[model samples]
Target chain A: MEIKKTSLNKLHQSNNAKFVEFAGYEMPIQYSKGIIEEHKFTRSHSGIFDVSHMGQLFIYGDESLTEELEKIFPLDLKNLKQNCSKYSFLMNEDAGIYDDLIITKIEEGYLIILNAACKDKDFEILSNLLGSKFKMNLDNNRSLIAIQGPKSVEILNSIINGVDQLNFMTGNWFNSDNQKLFVTRSGYTGEDGFEISITNDKAEKFVENLIEKGAKLIGLGARDTLRLEAGLCLYGHELDINKTPVEANLRWAISKSRLSNGGFIGSKKIMNQMQDGASQIRVGIKPEGRLIAREKTKIFNDTDKQIGEITSGTFGPSVNGPIAMGYVDKEFSKVDTKILLEVRGKKHPANVCALPFYKKNYVKGVN
Target chain B: MSEVKFSKEHEWITLEGDVATIGITKHATEMLGDIVFAELPEKGSNVEKDGTAGVVESTKAASDVYTPVSGEVVDTNQAIVDDPSKINEDPEGAAWFFKLKMKDQSEMDSLMNKEEYDKFAKESAS
Candidate 1:
């Protein structure tokens, strides 16, 4: 099958980006500046990304739409004010996660943003759950772009007005050159930025305008390292159908009202797990040697007993050392606990560290 | 004076008198992307041809460097060890990984010349 190319494919190619196939899309993995430079650029300056492959959906119905959504997700949608967004998940009957997503309560309805690779599966699962109670419109034609870095707001302010008023996790509809679009103050880079949802017809022009305004286009290579350093979870790596939010350290997404009301899908099992604690918990690892502990590396205790496996690992550009996140037995998931990572048949000493291995500079005053 | 030779794994060795200077080729450095770190063999250590001599790591992947010719490592480039990006910037010159005292002169003939190595790199990319 032919891989789908993003609208900015040519732009990336012109900039000499190394393209790679990711989630059925031909995307840029790095550029001429290389991954380290790009990763540092995002932290120090501004980095733009073409994330149009991510899924965007609109769920509309009567006043009961939020009530119906509450039945499937564990978030407290009743208190979700308009234009505010919440990170949530779709759970199976057994309380296992189907997919993790961000749901924004829009003016007229709900806007759900999902992982690119899990889009179809998520839609099918949500459709089967809702079943005639709500109308679901898939906006696959719309493209998504992220402008991330410390200078993102300053760069965006030069073009769009009133964007400074948007706090974290909030969104607003805006018009640019007679084109309608939605902008959200959210990003995966752990930096303060915005994710712009634009029509396919206007994506090219919108990206060009942003680039012309001094935004450096980053690729998947840097995006992975940036998020990894931030201790943010990638969908397939940190979360999957077999894991729940409680195990993935995503308890913040589970609202207090949902814990009390207990009306949502998998609430009994999820809440029970929350109360009793999960068997395995995600923890960060800082490897002693320069050799990186890549994905699938085994984590062992001092006694050489297998404890966990690395889900994501890399030579973090920001951290300047090998860093990883993995699921360890609950008993060993304490801060500063020493562990060992078996990399290439040799054991390297590691220490359990705090999350967000690199502190995020999301809003200077807020964070 | 002897001509430079390259291995299929992209390592290059140049023989001058009884000493051979070794490092990765430009093609290899470009494919590895931004190199973050390198593990080098200690000076005065013996290595065998076609054996693992050291390691080179990029942000995306890590690979072992094989000794193209058997010798005793006499000296190592401390500059590349300090900043691995030198391999990406000048793989052929300043990025030379190590200097070795050749144990067998016949081992030099086993590697390919510039023309053959260039062709091999192009075909392998395809």
Candidate 2:
């Protein structure tokens, strides 16, 4: 199958970026500055990401629409105020996750953003569940551009006035230079940033403006390392249909009201599992040696018994060491607990560490 | 006089008498992007031509450095081990990985010349 190219493909090529196929899209993996430099740039300055491949879905209905969504998702949509965004999961009837998404409560309806690779499957699942009951629209013609870094606010403020007033996790309809945009102060990277949903036709021009303002274009390679350092979960790696939020260390995303209501799909199984405690819990691992603990590397106890497997691993630019996330037995999930990662038949010692290996410095405007 | 030979895996070897110094080609380092860490074989270890002698890890991926000629590892560049980015900065000169005592001088005949290896690197990139 032919891979899809984004509107910024030409720009990436002209800049001599190394391209790699990711999630069915031919995207830039890095540029001349390379992954380490790009990762550091986003942490210290500002970096722009071409995440246009991510799926954007809009749900519209009457007053009962929020309640209807709560039935399919595990989010307490009723309490999610308008213009606020919440991370939630769409689960199967058995409580296995279908996909994790960001649900933004808009003025007219709900805006759901899903992983690019799982877009088609998630659309089919939502259609099969809420086809006749609600109206759903997939905006495939739009593009998502994430401007991330500590200086993101300054860069965005120069382009769109009053955006600095918006707080984290809130979104607003933005009008700039005759272009309409849905601007949200949300990002996958654990930095202060904005994900701007723009029309495909206007994406190039918008990206050019940001680049002219000194926003370096980062690729998926840095994106992975950044999110991993922040201890954020990726869909296929840290989460799958069989894994619940409880096991993924995302219990905070589940609202207290929803826990008692038990009205959403998979709630019976998920709630029960929550009460009993999840058998496997996701934890961060920092290797003692320079050798990285790559994906599928088995974690073992001191006696050499298997405990878990690494889901994601890399030399985190921010942390300046090899960092990884894996699922281990609940009893072995304590911080500073020593474990061994078997890589290439050799055992490398590692320590269980806390989430967000790098402390995030999110920019907060003066209140 | 020293004669430099290239391996198909993009490693370069400079032979002076029976001593041979090895490192990844400048082209290979460019292709690998950023050099973060390297795993060098211990001095005195045996290595065979085209065999995995060491490992070079970039931020994005890891690659094995194969020996261009069979020999025993006599010395390693601890400077590169302490600062692997030297490979990215100067892949040909100061970034040589290790030194080996040549087992057979004729082994150099199996390697490519500088011009031939340059073309090979270009073709592989495209």
TM-score of chain A of each: 0.97, 0.98
* Residue B24 in candidate 1, Cα distance off native in Å: 1.0
Q: Which candidate is the best by DockQ?
A: 2
Alpha-carbon error at B64 in model 1, in Å? 2.2
- CAPRI category for model 2: high
Q: Please state the i-RMS of candidate 2.
A: 0.9
Clashing pairs in 2: none
TM-score of each: 0.95, 0.98
Model 1 misplacement above 4 A: A364-367, B42-46
Give lDDT tens digits, candidate 2, residues A274-295. 8998999999999986778888
After TM-score superposition, the amount by which residue A346's alpha carbon in candidate 1 deviates from its true location, in angstroms, is 1.0
Model number with the top TM-score: 2
Interface quality of candidate 2 as DockQ: 0.82
